[model samples]
Target chain A: MHSFESLSKDFAAFFQKSHFPDQPASLYQPADYFLGLGGKRVRPVCCLMGNELFDEILPDTWQVATAIELFHNFTLIHDDIMDKAPLRRGMATVHSRYGEPTALLAGDVMLVVAYDYLNKVRSEHFHRIIQLFNRTAREVCEGQQLDMNFEKSETVSLDAYIKMIELKTSVLLAASLKLGAILGGAGEGNLHHIYEFGRNLGIAFQVQDDYLDAFGDPDKFGKQVGGDIMANKKTFLLIKALESADPALKAELDALLQSNHPDKVEKVLAIFRACGVDEWAKTLKDQYLSAAFQHLDDIAVLSKRKEPLRSLANFLVQRDY
Target chain B: MHSFESLSKDFAAFFQKSHFPDQPASLYQPADYFLGLGGKRVRPVCCLMGNELFDEILPDTWQVATAIELFHNFTLIHDDIMDKAPLRRGMATVHSRYGEPTALLAGDVMLVVAYDYLNKVRSEHFHRIIQLFNRTAREVCEGQQLDMNFEKSETVSLDAYIKMIELKTSVLLAASLKLGAILGGAGEGNLHHIYEFGRNLGIAFQVQDDYLDAFGDPDKFGKQVGGDIMANKKTFLLIKALESADPALKAELDALLQSNHPDKVEKVLAIFRACGVDEWAKTLKDQYLSAAFQHLDDIAVLSKRKEPLRSLANFLVQRDY
Candidate 1:
């Protein structure tokens, strides 16, 4: 039984350096600049943990794992351009520092290079792997499009938002787990259960992000809080608030939301508290976490090997920032 | 043998129809808007022609031929954004009409779906086909980056621009031909020679674009002459003009380029013509065409089957519009 903590810690250092070919200069600096921006390596870690649960190791495991990282960074680079985000990992966003044209092409090349690594997978499994890669890649793009589409619509239903996030964010996490299982020759039933666990956890994790960005403590959060409220973005909190609010409360919320002043953040937070929106968001987050655990429990693996997966999910949902 | 005329008519008509799942309604609306604006599908037609030269009665050949067209449209969508070009095919460009964000994502998805077809290739040849696709994709990105870099710098050597176009534009054309050849199961040696032939022809085609944009008939060409010069773009004409001009001539050309006045197009055209820049550009275009022909001659296939390819290149190079 490997604790997910142990697996994650190992995979956290996953792809610590370039694994294939003569590397090129990042053209900006540190070819791994964004790569080193520490993500939990959560998705790829799911891959390795799934592999371990199946008790198999494929050589060039790093190739696929590193590819997940490449795909992730590539998405981030383009998403930053779309989101107009200025900072990532406490550094200037690639588009902000290097300009959009460079950022776009850098992201483009990273995706192509990701395939270069995938090409090295053993021939026996190669077709299945490439098929998985293609399907996952398309889902990620579809997810992104849906995410963008959510922004333009005047109203987004809570269920639709969850589905959007699940596709946009969770499916990659799901794909990461499934990919490792396929590589490890895991049985079909196990792959199905593992995918469910990863997808549910991914949704829970993003709900955590939405909650943390709004309600997190200033110092502990590691960045400014209430970014969702400030951007007037319709996250779980806002969508729920919109759905549940009485007419008067809804009017007040909309007014505060529409205000041009900086004090709008305080006004909205005050309304959310008065209406119990904060508690509601927290309760929903916990509900997702509970559902994810049930899915994890349903996996055929022994209780012991699943412990790590459970702990990782708990850590994510319970995070302060 | 398919005549160049028949090949162009055949592939363009084939590509005009809709295929593929998950394409946004807005996706290839630009293709219609752009493709309808009417430049020759010379590269794709060459792919079909090249494939037939190796073997007649090509199987499900349209799919491979259409993939090349899709890839070409992907490049144009992104390039129009980068160039900030207001028009294509003599109509409003994708970015200009649909807005940048839509153009960006639609272009991204177009590439993904390009591979969706590649995945549909017969299982035996799929690996080889995808590897070629991956290599071509990366080179195109590198070529685009180098091009963006040139826009910021003063000196863009003719050799540098040639290399840039080779990656940016030519290899995809080469790859298109190779993709068809691979689908036809042409020998590796034959594929390489065909690739060279297509690549050189692409370079020659681009040079012809530069030549005509300056020197072609404006009424017949359906656009302003010397527009690239007016924008101070680092096209071959400007590069040749810069390289060939004396310091006094260089200063005059530079001064004419600096003021992008309405009259400046007329002024730059005068200087370019007076200095024989058009003739220099035409001479290079002819040289590239000759090189392309020499490569075509290297092919083991009989000259009879090769007529469509040679005429296609000539039609592309010699077209007034």
Candidate 2:
């Protein structure tokens, strides 16, 4: 199979060229502005890669690929409005530029159009795919709720944080892979295995992102590196730190977390490193990766057939930006 | 058939009870709060009333009924954000109280859950029901886009304004009735007729609202009378006034519309009265209502069976408050 990046880039071009065509001219400009503000196109690319690993199906699985990407954009537009995010993917967010009402409508149209693409799928898997679509959509919203609730909790347990991240961040990635696999005529068992692989890998990938945010080189990273530390966000590192902190060190950790100092990010990072929280996070990442690989191996597909999927996982986890 | 208000109340309560089964309660609280801060519950009640006009199939129709209500609330929460309105039903709007992010997420959840309710249909109508859901959902988004576009346009001619409000405000009501008719086992020809009745009636109701705002007594009206006039909003009266104005009168009307005086509400109302816009609005409302009644007459169902529906329309259009 080709590198996932090029495949995704091709689909991005295809998808962006023909979005929101049915919307009123002005009503659609916001969605168009957002589609132009591009991203890594990870989920849709994974969908294609997941299919390529099994079999080459329709060339126009690109429509299904576009559907996945469109759904992702829908979540992002709505989430940005909720998150009060001013910029996304290095450009002004749709809500920030066009106002919330337009963004909301744009997101809604994106979702409907997602099904428009899905409706093009011609397979026995259509019923199963629709069921999966509805279920994944519900879980995504559940994840958003969990993430919001975490913000209000003074103390989020490590398990709670993991569960929330899995729901909010990873399920769609997992769903994307399964969608591609099912579309490629993979059996239920193998499809479930691929989904498991994607789910675990996604969890590990997110933890690495949390780790890199504190330790990554800002020059290599596209955005600010210590954003989570600065916001006192309860990422894996923070959750682990809180869980493993001793009585004496707990005070120090809290002080660093609560500090208003300009060097708060550095100070929090130092405390986390000294307490071996980074080591613990690395261990957890490996555990998730191992579980993901185990699921990948358990698939009936041979080692040679799985190489591309593994490569995609490595690329996702090892990204600097 | 039950009163529209009672049926709506029942559906609202049922939906609230069925939403989420605990944990991170924030996810469902917004729905609870907004449903509790009730209004006429006009759309869903109409759907329920439409269902009862046929036979009492089963209580499952209430799920779709509640779904319509939830969909309406979802739009309102998002609309509140766009209009920057601080109050809803005499209480703080969702965005104002919980912040925009929560409101956005809440609205997102509400829309998804709306479909969950739609999917609760009896197996017989399930196939067509999904199609109806898709159409209704898409049209609502299209309407919202038109409404946003209207904000930027200066002229907003009578024909354009009529089309805008028809899409923005009427489709959902029409969809609700049509969906109920389908679930209630009405034939296609009859379904089409009911849709026209509801859609034309929705247009008429909006025109009546526009009329009431400019001419109704503040003491009798629950909301601030002439609220649309104060905002220089494009309403039936304003559009009519602008259309019928002579060259000098048109210039003065434009000036008043562009004014920022403290008494802009009363000022615009006086201009509308001077231009006989109220009479023009009433005439337009009557035209739509007459069209709506004509649609009811065209329905294949016996008029005796639709008497309840007629009384419902009278309650909507003929009532003062």
Worst 10 residues of 1 chain A by lDDT: A19-28
Q: What is the TM-score of chain B alone in each candidate?
A: 0.88, 0.93
In model 1, which residue pairs have backbone atoms overlapping below 3 Å? A4-A308
Q: State the lDDT of candidate 1 residue by residue for A188-279, as single tens digits.
A: 88888888878878888888788778788888778788777888888988888888888998999878777867788777778777778788
TM-score of each: 0.90, 0.88
Give DockQ per model, in order.
0.47, 0.48
Residue-by-residue lDDT tens digits, candidate 2, A257-318: 77878988877887788789888878888889889999999999768878778888888776
Candidate 2 lDDT over B169-259, as tens digits, reads: 8888888888778878888788888999988888889888888887887787677887887777888888788888778878877887778
Tell me the tens digit of each residue's lDDT in model 1 across B206-244.
988887787778887766777677678889888887888
Instruction: Evaluate candidate 1 and give its CAPRI docking class based on DockQ.
Output: acceptable
